[model samples]
Target: MAQPHIAKVLVVGSVNGHLADFFAKVKKLDARYGPFSILLVVGNLFANSDDHAEEVISLLKNEITVSVMTYAVVGDRPLPRRVRERASLKSGEICNNLVILSGQGVLQTSEGVKIAYLGGRYISQCLAETSNSSIENSANAAEPTDRVAVDPENSVSVDKGNSTAGNNEEKGTAGSEISKEEKGSAASESINEGKDDTISDSPPDDDESTHAHFDKLAVADLISQVAAENEKTFQKAIAQPSIDILLTFDWPYGAAATSPHTASDLSPPSTQFASNKISHLCAAIMPRYHFAAGEESFYERQPWKYSDRISIGRGSSAVPHFTRFIGLGAVNASRNEKQRWFYAMNVNPLRNISQGTSAPNELPANCTTNPLFRFGKIARVLDTKSLPRVLSAIDSSGGGNEASLSNRGGQGKRPPPPLNYICHGCNQPGHWISDCPVKGQNKRQRSDSSPPSGYVCHKCKKQGHWRSDCPADSSTSSGHASDALSKCWFCLANPDVDQNLMAAIGEEAYVAMAKGALVAGGSAKDGFHGHFSPIPGGGHVLIVPIVHTDSLRRACEGSDNAGADQRLSAEIDRWTEAVSALFAEYDCAPLIFETSRCLPHVHTTLQMIPIPNAKAESVKPALEDLCKADGLALAADYPPAQHDGYFALRDPASGNDLFLHMPKGSKSFNLELGRKLAARILGVPAREHWRQCVVSEDKEAAERDRFIAAFSKHDFTR
Candidate 1:
């Protein structure tokens, strides 16, 4: 039999139906051809088109060697078109060999991979921006020297024009960095290579494959649809359109706490909010197509491809699992453009009924079992036939209306998944005790309820027990350690003896996690940032005022006063000047961050630490120190005196430790003790506050050396 000549072609188009159609044909020709070697398809292939690209890649790899590598670069812009002028410049990247056959002629390389860049200006722009930002970010990253520069204009290349076919057997020029062996295989005869050669000029025509592709596309479409529906629901709950849908990979499941939401949601110290809806959700997934033993057939490829296929939707229809959209509007807007901040105290999932105070015999109305509202044990599994129906149900008229309750037979229905099932002991369906295990448990001790008991312990493991009853640990201790390594009244708050004396214990935990890696060296293998950075403006500091809930109301009680109290205003101004001066030393400008939405007993301030030319990683520690350092210095100047006892005496030799001679006896020390000391030092009316506590036994030399090693080498002046 005569051998048919193989041709490598480059296809440029929107990567949706077209790419699927092209790959479908290749799959059908699997037995007929040794391999379809020369192929490069490029387009806006992220987001929706990403799945389609995977299918094409899978089909190609099955018949080819692993040496044949494929590349998919997300264009700098959104799909359909790309930005050419601003295309990302990936230096030293070459797509050398692939045989090229086109409408024009058999041109360029006869055995090489064809590299193509599809789309227009926007995509190119996105690519360029991403590449540049990456490089700049690297340069400003913890490892600054390894950053690379990309030449945008000259990044993409393709051999062009017409060339002779049969007469010219001349070797072709390869552009990209493809291997010689793979190049040889591109034009090799299928039968000669001892491989099947069944693929003809005709394209693929298989109904089953077509259906599968359609199903994949439908799934992608459904994700977007569901996302949109959820957004509207989120907006109604928060009374704002700026609510963001964040998917938290590590949030723990917990019952509702007190209504911290109503007490002025100023980041923390303020109580966390409570939502009426159920938050914890769990669901079982079942596949529609399960193989019957007698009917199933085993094969290397044929039957395996047709094996029992899985689909989505394993949970009950009556109680659909929903993800919560945390309203980030107030906090997001309050923060300076790109200033970084950490979430201090996290809000645990509030239960439908109050914990501890609730009765064992009766579950909250939201958690009770009602036939119309309860999900059936045997849920409908989604298959190709059922998937479309579910998607329609999610997007249809009934689903679009936000107020139209998903739960049946009442004015109130549990909102989503985590809330649907409660603990068996507590009669809440959201969690089963077997799986309702407490977090931070010993690896071997984690277990859930066989018998539904309302009493869950929150201590030792800190799950169901109150803070007062928490098991005492060696490391846990009371007291807020200020940034300056001075221990004050805040440091003595912990009952656990093992706790470190740090104001921001969470931040301290983060630093502990990053201990051994080289903190300042650069590596080529590390992610690259462009020569320029995306943060356009120079670094700046923002000073925010913190007012107690009582103080704010007293000041605002008068009808004649329409603005903030004079004393609070004066304090904010004084802090602003001091903070601005400090930022100026680092070549950064200071901006004030203040909000008049004052709540009871809560006084908080926000500071924006401008990094200017600082690397992202370096900024974290620097700013953290700045906050701590500022707090420490402020503590030193406060009214507290030696006898007042707010400040802990550090040995200076034992860094970040307290010189605790004895635990405070009730008669020995009281709230007035620290307050009196702080008042003596600062000549102010302020009490011994947690924020002003000095961290004792701090090793300044070691910390200073760490800062020098971590950031001194970087040119922060830029």
Candidate 2:
């Protein structure tokens, strides 16, 4: 139960085939620093060819006696053949005490320090060759280029056969940050130069150049990947911004070129291709210690504070966060050389806050829900006096001057809860109508409703009814300010998610056929819903809470210690467990997925899919590869008690679950990640798109009916 000790991590810039020299440096460090916990290699981790492979292999095999764990981001060059040949299929160990952190993902050391990595190299090649390039061009002035003496023996060319190797890599990545003129020219240039290459170079007619657009798209994808896996990290970076250590291959473009090895004098053009992608990303993920391995000489900049729009005045300054950029240089190539560029970082888990002596990293001592450090502390704590500007913009009472939310019934009267049953009007089982007691209501309500003959309701006609007398209740009658909440897509009473699609409805949750299911449809003769070819596949189901809410993260977080919220919590747990049980009954491997944009009115949805065993095994790796390309960290492990804001599912094979925590309700999030992954595994990538699989209305009805027939018996609500 002792408090965990700080981890000493060594951050090495580039090891351009300096195997012998690197080992010598390690030995010196062992003798000097004694025992570093981790050696994080950032840039060129391997020699391109076998020129230095034998020596490096020998060192890895025979001389690495220290227990220092090693990890690396992929460099511009492909991994050395020897290492790749012996590497685990994905993120497996390459040698003793060394595991190549494959693709973008997160892992926790036994010390309990969480390490989230987005492994990628800089795509801006031109920025490396000319100080006058786009990034440097934007700088005010550079004056310390000559202070660090260059070493001829330390040339990185030893690994790639040329000192200009940094500017020559683009095999699998789009080169970004070229001069604007070059970008424009590339867009209009004859893209057919590489006509024979696997990817076409033809530029789209849009103003952006083809290659430039590709870089932008690529960087956007990377940001999206990060958002996908660590949405809370992105938001936290914006709110209560603080990251202990951040590792990237290149510094943000506007950062002072502090490295004496980089040229100080240069004139740059007005624009560059996506030059601000990294800068914008950094601004959001405000790191306390930002380390980059792009330059050849070490440079350290005093921490610079950045003030964002959400910045609050703290201790005399309006600053939200600050970042200290440290640029590391390559180690020596020869046997006995050392360089100042290598960094020895000391990270104490409790440096910023209170830490007790008796607590381990897993269970930090002196812990309370210390409101001070939680993300979004600044935004949440703002008093009304400080928020006039923000509040003025929100329509607090009515849109179109409808009744107030708190007084929907006028004069401070709370509106009745939207009918809990399908319909409150005629007391129908599956549908809600204003006059449910009307003649022939029971059997008529069982089917989809259509407005009465010759009647055209002017208001709320979208539901196929006349406006004034439409089935739309007063809650959704446009005059009600709570219309949005009442008409929430997941609310059972909403016209959009009627009981027609639900087979099993429970107090807190419901079971419905997935809109874009992944599991293939089969014959009902098997005691399950048969195939719906028009809909692509059929076994997908959605286990959702009956009420409108954000994500599982929000649902659980907002639940209070008060007994009133316990049912909400219980309902969530019941639905989750029931999802697993349902999947088990069908002999299917349950792979669930969801992402929320944090909109309270938006209900959280979990997709439960069953895939073939072979396909199921491929899901994680496939996702990891995509995340790697985008430089996003996907976490797969967590300690149960600490699992907050995370979605987790245990793999039956390993008996261990994978957990990923991110912000929810992002409009950009694809809710169909499960379908997409299944598509990859099932060899139907085209159908992976959510919109592509919609079938005709009749077919959909048939699919839904079949699902209801299969699942109605399992309805726990009854």
Best by TM-score: 2
TM-score of every model versus the real structure? 0.20, 0.34
Please give the distance, in angstroms, between residue 91's alpha carbon in candidate 2 and its true position after superposition: 2.1
Q: After superposing candidate 2, which stretches have Cα over 4 Å from the reference?
A: 1-4, 59-67, 88-90, 119-242, 257-275, 307-320, 333-339, 350-718
**Weakest ten-residue segment in model 2 by summed lDDT:** 368-377
Q: lDDT of each model, Cα atoms only?
A: 0.23, 0.44
Tens-digit lDDT string for candidate 1 (65-179) = 2221222222222321111111121111112222221101111223211121111121112222332331111111111112111112112222222211211232221123334
Model 1 quality (TM-score): 0.20
Q: Candidate 1: what lDDT?
A: 0.23
Candidate 2 residue-wise lDDT, 510-613, digit = tens = 66676545454664335333222212236577777756656655455455533424666676566656655655555556666665434444567776666544
> Candidate 1, 128: how far from true, in Å?
14
